[model samples]
Target: MADNNNYRDTTHQSDLSISITPAKAGVGLLFAGGALTMHRILCLSALLMGLFSAVGVYAADAQQSEPVDPGIEGSAIDKSAKEKSDSGGSSFAVWESKYFASSPDNTGPAVEQPIEFPHFRHAGDHDKGGMEINCMYCHTYARRSLVAGIPPVQKCVGCHQSIESVRDKPRIKKLFEYWDAKKAIPWKKVHDLPDFVRFSHERHIQRFIFQLNRPVQEVCGYCHGDVKTMTVARRQKLLSMGFCVTCHEVKHPVTAEGGTPIGDQAYWYSMRKPIIDASGIIKAQGPNDCSVCHK
Candidate 1:
């Protein structure tokens, strides 16, 4: 009887140990799951806080007024508005000039370039510090290509290397740095047109500069503004459909002063063919048809 009782006691002790072991494992699992849940909640809270902070910062920035940089000129809207008001033009005139004139926003935002090339120093009038370099000398492709190609770095260094006077200048130093590194000066395009718009710099250059014999500066100015006076080039003209259409609608003289008829020297798209009016003067209009430009 004593042996049997001892055997029963050992079995009961073993069973109790097994039951307690399972309870402890269940408690541990519960604690681990709770901890995981708490961690996820904390992470979600942090993400929300970050998102809210970003939104608040954006709102604050949106409300704040942008400070004008002295180096950059004011937008065309501001200049035209003031000019119209000064001239005693009506509000409608001011509105029209601001939106529909040569450019809606002349002199666009100043694009920060690798080197701040001083257009005034290079292209400005001889009375000023400008070298009076011809536009064609650097932009050689304007008359020959669809796009006015950016000049290679070698072209700039070729001339700059000989000019020892301004070699030490900061801008020139930067130019040399790029040359030494064998990198192209990444010029930012200020007059960026939309991808869909088709513009042929060659056609315009051939017609105005070669055939019409218009001043290079004046012809370029019709779209680029007075870049000769600019430090860094900016979009001085609007280049909008309205600006283009306005010029196209007008009937311009087909011949230059010497009566050199604007024959099919260059393929120019026009709504109507060159016509001889009652005054015996040949006149041609620019492309007014959608297909001529849209394609």
Candidate 2:
């Protein structure tokens, strides 16, 4: 009996030490499973990151070493011109605001010319630190060509050769440098039109200005603003088709007594569309012909 009781006690102690409660066993199993799952997820994430990094490095290296396609480089200007010519000229000549120029180039709205050519000083009052120079004298081609050509350095040196007062001035000194080198001043072109649009200075000069015998300022002010005041030139006109069309549609009244003026250029633009003879009868007239502008 003693031996049996001792055996029972030993068995009971072993059970107490080895056997776990149901809640504790379940918690242990859950912790172990969670640990295994987290380990798998972390290993997978590391592998994916390595693959992505290698791909990114390879892509960067390929991009830096590769040459761009050759055909894309030279086709831009040609394509642009072809489109414009095909369209038979768009009325919106200077569409982009940043592209517009009056007197061109520089960081801001005002461009510092190679020589700081002061329009205000040259164009303003003679008594007020001004020479009051005539614009046509400098822009000789304004009366003749589509381009109002920049005056040659020789033209500038002509008068400047005798003027002793401002010879050492920095702007004047720079002028002398170009003159000495016999190089063009590389004057920036202010007014630039697109490839398709064709504007004739001769036609406008002959038709509206010379025919009407108007003031030079009023005549040029149709496109160029009152440049007499501005030190640096700026584009004032919109130069759009609508603005031009409005000008064409408006008439200049006859200034003399007992006189009737012709009603704008649009009236006479047609080819016998509204035919009228000198004897008392008036016919239809208007100037909305596309061919007149777009050729």
Candidate 3:
């Protein structure tokens, strides 16, 4: 009886110990799970903060890079006054007259020797040769770079290597010598805009040719004139500030309805186009303040 009682006591103690062990393990597992969950929360919060900071930095950078718009009110008035001043009594003939002579002394019977480059003989449909090459072929850097670079003599000799049998072509032969010596030809600039104006061939070509779906030749013809027909180039137009402003005005004309001039309306309509409000109502923006261009 004593042995049986001892065995029963021992079995009861083992069962009690097993139940307590499970409870303790459950508590420990719950604590570990809570800690893991807290860590995940902290990591997620840090990730969100990092993303927010990055976005704020990008927004600030974008704002700094963007170009400031000068107001339209003063710009419109200035442009209007300029037009009136230019056209009030100034004759076109007077404007066309040369201000400076070729020589400083103004002597030698005014050697106004026109370079009569036979475009017909060089490029036109003649039996000898009529190479229908692109204008950018000669002015190679027109598309890719800021300045339209004039081709050196090496570019000419690439084709003239076989045509050495031509008669009395001293200029062509000189080009060969320059090519052999690897020297650049000194070509005079024909179309010279003021240094202040930031005119870029690349930007114009990218906009008109690539974006606006215009032909390259037609776009280039605006500034270069008919390059295909010209062997010796000349400035075809007087590219003045007024000229640019006039074109801008035409494209975005002022449309006033009341006694007060809708200067802001005209400005926005001209500056921002297809991206404007569908209702065609011009949103007021900064005026053509002096700092816009002068700066």
Candidate 4:
């Protein structure tokens, strides 16, 4: 009986040891699973933070790279408005000359014969042979002086002196006669600004030529229009006082149509209106202060 009881006690002890081993194994597995899940959560949080930081940096760089658009804020509105008021009447009339009479005496010889000079015809290109010279070669002072000078009889004679038998045209013959008589040719002024206004060829040329680095041909066209195509030069631009003021106020270096640079040509830099037509003739009103212009 003692032997059988000892055997039963040993068997019970073995069974208890087996059960404890399985419980220990399950607890170890649960702890490992919790640790792995925590590590994965931390890795995911770090990745999300890195992505957010990258996006923020990209946004800042984009803003800095953008270009600034200059608004039309610095304009002289008052001067412009006044110009519009003055030019409101007789928008089409050229210079208001005192000598101009509406009607001439019918009995008298036709005093002013219209010079039927076709600007387009002479400027056109022909298939057989034709060469066009720029207007500035003859009207050299247009870009450098306030008034574009008409070619003197001497200048015409420089070329005409050599050419013979081409005196059929009255204007050409008249030019030669003026040269022979040592008299100045009386060419009608086609475009004249008002007396009170001040305009500068030097300023425009300097800004466009020296500062902006524009070619002469392109710069001259701003006022003269395409002289290459015109036979008889007419007033191409309205050249109104308001037109001058508008250009001053907007402060664009070049007209928007041409991608020309206005650069330092902006009026504010000069501290005075550079161009004015105040005298009612193409009157330009520079800055209002006396010191602005006189000083």
Q: List the residue pairs that clash in candidate 1.
A: 103-238
Candidate 2 Cα errors over 4 Å, as ranges: 1-109, 252-287
Q: Write the per-residue lDDT of candidate 1 for residues 1-295, one digit (tens) a residue.
A: 1111111111122233344454555554555555555787765655555555555544433433233222222232234334433443243333434543445355467688878888888888999978888888888899998787878999999999999998999989989999999999999888887777888899889977898777787777677867899888877666777567544533232332233334754325443445555566554445533555665
Among the numbered candidates, top TM-score falls to 1
TM-score of each: 0.56, 0.50, 0.46, 0.44
lDDT of each: 0.60, 0.52, 0.47, 0.46
Per-residue lDDT of 110-151 in model 4, one digit per residue for the tens?
Answer: 223234444444344454233445556677786778666777
lDDT of 3 at 61: 42
Point out the worst 10-residue segment of candidate 4 by lDDT.
1-10
Taking the tens digit of each residue's C-alpha lDDT, what string does model 3 give over 1-295?
1111111111122233344444555554555555555787765655555555556545534433332223344344345434433443222223322321223332122122122334434544445465656557777788777788867667777777877575247666666666778877666676666566666678766766677766555667665545556566655544564444443432333333221335545344333321223465433322232233332
Residue-wise lDDT of candidate 2 within 1-295, one digit each (tens)? 1111111111112222233234444554455555555787765555555555545545534433333222222133234333433442322232322343332441124445666677777776677777767666787787788766789999999999899998998878999999999999977655555556667777666665577665555566567655677666655665665445434422211112322335654445432133333453433322334555666
TM-score of 3: 0.46
Off by over 4 Å in 3: 1-129, 164-168, 252-295
Candidate 3 lDDT (Cα, whole model)?
A: 0.47
